[model samples]
Target: MQYFTICAMEDTDLSSDSDLDALINCTLLYAATKFKRKKRIWKSSYLRKRETHGEFRLTSEFSDDQFTNYFRMNRMQFEEVHNTIQNKIYHEGSRAHKEITTKEKLAVFLRYLASGNSYKSIGYSYRLGDRTVSKIVNEVSAAIWECLQQTFLPDPTEELWKQIAKEFEQRWQFPHCVGSIDGKHIVVKKPAKSGSSYFNYKHTCSIVLMATVDANYKFITVDIGSMGRFSDGNIFSSSILYKKIQNKTLKLPEPDMISGGEKELPYVFVGDEAFPLLENLMRPYPKRKVTANYENKVFNYRLSRARQTVECAFGILAGRFHVFRKPFEIKLASVDNVVKAACVLHNYLRMTSTATNVEDIADEELLSDQLTSIRYNNSRNSRNAFLVRENYTHYFNTTGAVQWQRDSILRGKY
Candidate 1:
């Protein structure tokens, strides 16, 4: 070996400046090529091992309970969603390599939503890059919102509204009520260049989720991505739902006769004092200096009871998908998609889950009242709205009264 090396160096003419330079360049190029090959080998081996043993693999290995606990969904539900959005999420493999399966992408998205894990942490567990994880999560969440909106949260027809009103009456003992309306602050990271627009009274950066829920704790309609600094009344006034109601374009059912009286009333949504009282919307009487009469008290209690459904819906939403419990460290648009997806998933789960009692999942802490003061609208029909409220107050005290309503009012147990 020594003789061959000496002979090769003698033949290569190491004495010339140009030859030496060529030799050095060639040697450096050879070394770089060798290093790159070794790096490729190591990365391929690591990825193969990770694919074989990482948490993504465990998803298939897990038992039913483990699967449910990890993904916050059953196999059937996962398959249903996967099938609906398979075309959207599917990526055709190229000659370079096989694309990640749609199933894997969905699994990553669900795991992120269920665990609320950071992108880096989730990517590590799933053997993906953080950017890939983020891309998959956002894509899958947007697909969920688009694919499930019609089936899970379609606008209600007149008949459906009446059905909702009937459910409210039967389940909550509230007459002529269709749904409960409320708003929640979805905490988020401070947005770039957003000043105090997203800063809420709670001192946290957030977006508002204004939703109307039916008696079964299902979201009938939702208006999300409102500025957190806006009041609930302001948010509602700007919502599409409110606009439809205002223009009488929602095709609400005709007035129905009160159960025990000849007076007919339009179906109305029940809200708290943070909302303005309208002919089609009822809020509790102000709890300030004005003493609420017995009839007003009963009406308030009944409205509160009905309004509890929307609160409980939010509770169940946060409890099941705990991502809402923490501040989402993402862009504002991404947060909106995440929230919309969560809302649709909440409705889907509620429709399919076997748990009959809402108390099992409802987070009462989220339902606590946030009403600050009575918000009065400056509409021309303001006095007429008050008279409408008074009429309902009278009806609750007399014809539409319930046996236990009086006792509930007396005990101050709304």
Candidate 2:
């Protein structure tokens, strides 16, 4: 049998364990110590150093070059924002160290978010250590969240509620609707040795992000960090919405004609079956009739229209940042920060964008008409007749009361 030797072109006598160890050490040394030859000049310099020293010493020189190069690049970008971040970290608003600026650190963090890359990848791009990259990402994200919350989410005031109600009417054609409520599961890989707390009905570990969005797809309320094992209904029941409902402190806008001055009247919000049925909270009927009438159809239509904003809010966050589009692999504890940051950023962008009115999205009437047409068309075909028939029957049977309520409000009978 023939054996290969390190740097060997042919079989040799130097095939001992020490020889093999030396070869392995030399390979590691080369990878760690070699200068990243950016140009012919750099390559020549590195080659000259290698010739001057033995292989091991040459490797050490290259390692130092690599380390210094990485440190220098990282410091350049970090220095730009060092002071701003130091002030934030110190909370004294003092002049930051001239060495680095917070804006630079923030820019690096945003670059990570926009790219959805790993810390190591980000470090390589910024020429920093992975640990430093991780720290910057977390700190900058916290700062961004703080900045956004201060600017975007105000304390619940009557004026804010009134504005929200007006936006609802104008954007969704849903009168007196305070907000659209929904819950979404953000999938995550199951952690080792952890309990089954994160495992949901979807047979995967996840966390729930429940939100109340206004008609224009702006978040009015956000609750994160719910275990995925709980049902959406269960999560909602445990949320601040439930508390607000119980305490009756959520003093929303009174129902009033969109054409007239706000007459203090009762209005309702739309949710799905996951929420409890309440006079102030409207939900789609669990079932429909085969011969659904205009009222039943209208109830389902209006409910869907009001509920869509929450879906759209979730869609925008997930779509714009693909990081949450798939299962995450981090620790469960960090899920809340990710969700909160996403929500805060969503609101921040909405506030800054000129398209805040949501005129760019499809109108509710057009969407409703298309959906209804599809249902009617599908019901006529026997292939989908049973399901369609069930849907039709369910609406008339369960949604009649809601339709009447909406009509009564419209007619000033309530």
Candidate 3:
């Protein structure tokens, strides 16, 4: 009708039936094309009301235990983390479409992290666009790292290192032990055009997250985003942590004696069989197929105890932030930020939640830091490392020995 009205207003000649038919067909086609696309709308209404939903209710109406289950942290701890990153994540505007508040952004990001839900799924729950969900996660992750890294996961200081060593001695009974260092393969989808670099022995593509954690299950240092194909030992050896130790760049304290034991030893990080036994890094002695020596058994048992800190740390991370259980959506550049964010959050929770379960583990599987120095000569260092292990072994068996270590639990599985 409009096309005809325009023709009539211009007094255009349309006497021919064929021409009139052609004009009508063209107009109908144009109209169909114009209306075919869905109309754009503002304000996601009728999807879900986050205000009346868990985002608000979880804070006020729900119990702290329920809140912890959903966000992976109690309300108090969550509030502390939110407060630190709130300014950075705050969206300032007065657009017709409501802006996601800092709290909502954090809630969205934490929901994604705490549940490992797809962006679309989380978006549906929060009435957000999938892209918005992704953006919020990335943004919050960066903010968490930027705002909390120094206080929560800062580089080890001399005095802080001493304090950590003291805690280990008192808690885990490993004197001069500063932290436990270990690495786990974080599974990720194979990257584009890259062949075999990320492939690992388990027939999966992954990146390694290496961390050093103190006795109280707090991460002291972290190194992440290493290629997974490399063996754990090789990865550690080539790491900046290893390089610093080799070059003597870490401000490791001078050699000192244990409080209740003899033989002066340097501060060390305990690791599993994947790491070499260094003067400042202790590893268990190799298991024997035949009858094992009594001293080696006792030494391995004690080292295993110190090493459990890293194991439990990883377990708690996987248990709480379940994203670690499955293969991560393959993202290289942003993976470090995400992993680092999770680790920092772990520290935050450990620092704030006094009665929290530090021993939590992921069901069935998904198991998966501190420093040691180096010697220039491989042979000499090997000799020195053996002597150091022997020193700790003798110390544990005699003066430093605890009553519980005498139990039958000293038996090594391997």
Could you list the CA RMSD of all candidates, in the order they appear?
3.8, 14.6, 5.3
Q: Across residues 17-129, which tens digit of lDDT does each residue of candidate 1 receive?
A: 88777666666766776676773332354445556776878878889977887888889988999999998888886654547789989998888888788899888888877
User: For candidate 3, lDDT tens digit of each residue in 88-127?
Assistant: 9888755556667888888887877788877788877776
Give candidate 1 misplaced runs (Cα > 4 Å): 1-46, 95-97, 288-292, 357-362, 366-381
- Residue 304, candidate 3: C-alpha displacement in angstroms: 0.8
* Candidate 2 residue lDDT tens string, 1-414: 012224442333346777666666666666554444322242233333422442223323445435223222133333433443456643222232122235545545555544566767665555555676677666666665665676675556667777777788776666567888777777877878858987877677877777788876778888777777775466776888767865778876554543432233345666766666555566654455303454454556656767877776666665445466457666665556666766766675666554433322533223221111100001112333233323332443353234355564355321
Q: Rate the local accuracy (lDDT) of all candidates.
A: 0.79, 0.56, 0.77
Off by over 4 Å in 3: 1-10, 13-61, 94-96, 358-381, 409-414
Provide the lDDT at 171 for model 2: 68
Clash list (residue pairs), candidate 3: 211-369, 212-369, 212-370, 213-369
Model with the higher TM-score, candidate 1 or 2? 1
TM-scores, one per candidate? 0.87, 0.62, 0.84
Sort order, lDDT high to low: 1, 3, 2
Alpha-carbon RMSD, candidate 2: 14.6
